[model samples]
Target: MKQTVQLAGLSCQNCVKHTTAAFSKLEGVESVTIDLDQQLAQVTTDTAYQVQDYQEVLGPLPYKVESVL
Candidate 1:
């Protein structure tokens, strides 16, 4: 499954690294690609994941999950 997650507060490469690390840790996630300029993440997973799940994963971070599509 593939999902595009719109994010907020991503200002640098460090934010991209952090976001990638966080999502990459999820059990079923295969890969995570972040576009720092667009503030988006394209995640490829082996299982279905909801927007809430993504939000929860990023809850403690400086970035916010604006939406999922």
Candidate 2:
């Protein structure tokens, strides 16, 4: 499964790094790509993974997830 999420309030690459680290810790996550200029992240994971599961990963961030697709 793949998920693309829009994020708000990420100001720099460090924010991207933080977000990537958080998602990478999830059990099934295979890859994470953050487009800091666009404030979006694309995550690729196993078939069993669900986007809802990532909510927990983003919960502590300064940015809020704007959408998931």
State the lDDT of candidate 1 residue by residue for 21-44, as single tens digits: 888888889999999989989999
Candidate 2 structure quality by residue, lDDT tens digits, 1-69? 888887789999899899999889988789999999998889898744445666677777887777778
- Native-referenced Cα lDDT, model 1: 0.88
Taking all chains together, each candidate's TM-score versus the true structure is 0.90, 0.82
Give the local distance difference test score of model 2: 0.82
Looking at model 1, the pairs that clash are none
Mark the 10 consecutive residues where model 1 has the least summed lDDT: 50-59
Give the RMSD in angstroms, all C-alphas superposed, for model 1: 1.0
The global C-alpha lDDT for each of the candidates, from Candidate 1 onward, is: 0.88, 0.82
Model 1, TM vs. native: 0.90
